[model samples]
Target: MEKISSENPSIEKTKFIKSKGLKDKPHNYCPGCGHGIVHRLVAEVVEELGIREKVIAVAPVGCAVFAYDYWNFDVTEAPHGRPPAVATGIKRILPENFVFTYQGDGDLAAIGAAELIHAANRSENITIIFVNNTVYGMTSGQMAPTTLLGQKTLTTPHGREVLRDGYPIKVCELISVLDGARYVARGSVTTPKNVLTTKSYIKKAFLNQIENKGFSIVEILSMCPAGLDMEPLETMEWVDKELIKYFPLGVVKDV
Candidate 1:
């Protein structure tokens, strides 16, 4: 029996290396959390675009508050629900640099609602990666602004009631109507195909910023197994079957 050599052409050897834009550190995200996947996608995109040196990401005060530890670039912490404001200031001062914000639903659609709206209205040349997991992962399993109508969370144990909870805010659709929002789309990470699609949306957002386009946002529907109090597979199923019903996928606006 002859042993196969690693240099053999028929072996089709493949090398897997960590993204250059990502730090060689373990992420603090919970098991089966989508944050890690999204982080890798962002890191890969930045490295591919060759913009890692000019990137400055504004970290939100949610689950990804310590994003600076994982990303190998300049990252600044912002007050609760104030990433958009902080990113705006950074972009204004360093107009030549690439600026973006990583925010969760609670930070973007709840306390930071005004900031999000005004930023889109002003057509700020920046990219926003909004992660919507229905519930706040860092602060227990509380219902978020984008919580589903029948979702059960720490605050909505009896499932959300439309009369009391109103409706889940659709970030992409709401911002698509603003003239300043040149690009708006929603993506998910429930399956491999969806993951690739989400990456494409994120890359498009970054490209828009590189071309000096106005406000661009990619709202990503993520799975939070711990926050939902469900198994990892169950959370993925919920996102694909139920959540997508309320917030459909695809591009909502592109100008």
Candidate 2:
């Protein structure tokens, strides 16, 4: 019998190759929106891991709904706020394949809170890439669960009031408190350095899934320039100063 490693030498070579998962079509994300950057990092990580063919990505119904178009892998569309439930079913049925869910803040933290928490508590063998941009981008800038205090959105025209909406949900910290989650980290794509770190975290999350370590999630604090009505550069600066102040950068939990 041919040795598995010898039979797939490209697996080793893939680590040094450029990603082919991204499509040439320009992404529709607003300039400086961190979702695009995180998407690229995830594509690169999947390429480096050489699991593009066997991987299954569940795209959530939000701004990232078109993610399947960019990723060169088997993909399925899940209802709004249902990616975690879909990912749980997919991973449970096909344990050999790598399963992942990509979701926006509104989808994951608001409508899908139960699914996210339950999946993590179950220790499902799945990886989740959670993008927290603080607004409902595809739905016209509604306030999301992660929206900061006093931030105005289409839904909260007068800014989010603490008395009514409360503060932003710190998802990483919340999930880290769960015993079933093997790894939980908060990352960002605000700068090139941060992008690189995000990629490393994604890769580690994928590896942990392959090893059946348990459910893992990487919450990325992304920018939404159009929604925020700020220029691209200014949006990035805001991420560095304002966003980071609320969602401090670092791994919240890894086990």
Per-candidate TM-scores read: 0.94, 0.91
- What is the C-alpha lDDT profile of model 2 across 121-177, one tens digit per residue? 999989999998889888778898998898889989899998999889999999999
Query: In model 2, where do residues sit more than 4 Å from their true spots?
Result: 1-18
lDDT of 2 at 107: 94
Lowest lDDT sum, 10 consecutive residues, model 2, at: 10-19
CA displacement after TM-score superposition, residue 240 of candidate 2 (Å): 1.0
Q: After aligning candidate 1 to the native by TM-score, how far in Å is the CA of 250 from where it should be?
A: 0.5
Model 2: which residue pairs collide?
Answer: none
Clashes of 1: 0
In candidate 1, position 5 carries an lDDT of 56
